[model samples]
Target: MNFATRPNFEAISSAPVMQRARGTARIGTKQRDGKTCIDTLFQEGCGKIRLPRTHSSALEAVFINTAGGITGGDHLRWGADIAPEGRLVITTQACERSYRSTGDTAHVEADINVGADAHLDWLPQETILFEASKLDRRLTIRLDEGATLTAIEAVLLGRDAMGEEARDAQFSDTWRIFRGDRLIHAEATRLTGDGSERDGLSLLRGCRAFASILHVAPSADRAEQLLDRVRALHPAAGLIAASANGERLVIRAMARTGLALRKLLVPTLIELTGAGSLPRLWHL
Candidate 1:
């Protein structure tokens, strides 16, 4: 074979092939023995779910990502459906970490449905982004007119104790909530830059950690009661604010570190969920 016409087998063999993690986890609940129980579960690839023993009447699920952390090109999805009159609580096994990426951004999606008179509490752990990381996440929830839902999403730029900083990072988060075909709440957040923009008064304002909490109920009275209880707690740390809109209550908080953010989040979450305590995984 002529040298010019021959394929470069050496270069082809030397080039590295990228492997990305992709997985989906789905769970559904039903009423059993007068208590909510797992009805169906499906997990594939790097996604995993566990049902730890708990004393609460609601069924609890813990999500796990076997890939360890997310980077460019990784995709993960989670879904949950609660049957009529059922109760469910969902949480992650640990905080999700987003590492540096070369090109594409990592993506995560959550879709949840609440049936008539059902309730769902989504309390995933915080997500930490390292320098140069890019992440895109979205959460969509549909509820029946009689259903209730409480959800929390928190993010940290980097760990304060580790002296890490995500000065160069890109993150986008979107949340949409609907009840009986009507959109009740919608929020979108985007952050991109060398982190200096966070100093703006309307932005994070020098805080390295932030979170959003949402609670929805059939009656405005219930939403108001939870809002009042959260205000009474008066988290000793972090800057926290709560507001009510019709049948929905929303809380926003910012802090210098993850610990301080949690101090503000825990009580508010407890009040919104009305569970008296969070999922056991939160303590671990």
Candidate 2:
């Protein structure tokens, strides 16, 4: 065989680049002295949990990704079970970053089970996608009858402060939440690439940071007050909007800057669910 015309041996067997990380974490709830606690927990690989911290009456579970960030061919799985009457809050230690991928897309999946009368707050931090990155993430919640569930998902196109540009990226994020056999809320957000950011379709309207919050419970108390507060804080006419149908509340917000988008998130969450102050790691 001709040496130069033959297939390159080194390129065909690139062993190191194909290695990927996998993480799994599971948390189960229980009762102790009339208070809810994390009864059973399992963590491996990059998935980790910060021992529940005393937070008034509820327990806070802080999840950490030891791999630091995700890239092509990486997989992350997280799950939690809320016992009857258990109240728990979950948050990430810091924003998760998705890097440019040369091969397969990165994946993140979360499954939450809430028992009757149980309350769960799924508040993971933002996911930032770098230029040419590919990420597909999904979160599913199965709530028993009378269960209270709240969740927030945020995404940033690129690192705005660093003057970086996400000229090309692929993102598909989905949320499916159910109560018993009924599906109360279903949302899917997709960005095939970064071409639409500068367009004039009115969708996103050149915004780099976007967020969505879903609350399903017996009551959406102070929601009107939360709307008023959102309007007061964000005088910008259409940056934020909220709607409610009995116990289900949905809020969507976008901003040209991350600071502004967050300004709308914190206060809205505090006033809407009245879930007490933001998670401590959120401030740090």
Highest TM-score model number: 1
TM-score of 2: 0.89
lDDT (tens digit, per residue) of candidate 1 on 91-154: 9989999999988899999999999999889999999999889999999999996998999999
Model 2 agreement with the true structure over 121-219: per-residue lDDT tens digits: 888888898988999999999999778877899988789889765758788898888888888788898887756653456777788888998877565
Computed on alpha carbons, the lDDT of every model, listed in order, comes to 0.89, 0.82
C-alpha RMSD of each candidate structure in angstroms: 2.0, 3.6
TM, every model: 0.95, 0.89
| Worst ten in a row by lDDT for model 2 | 222-231
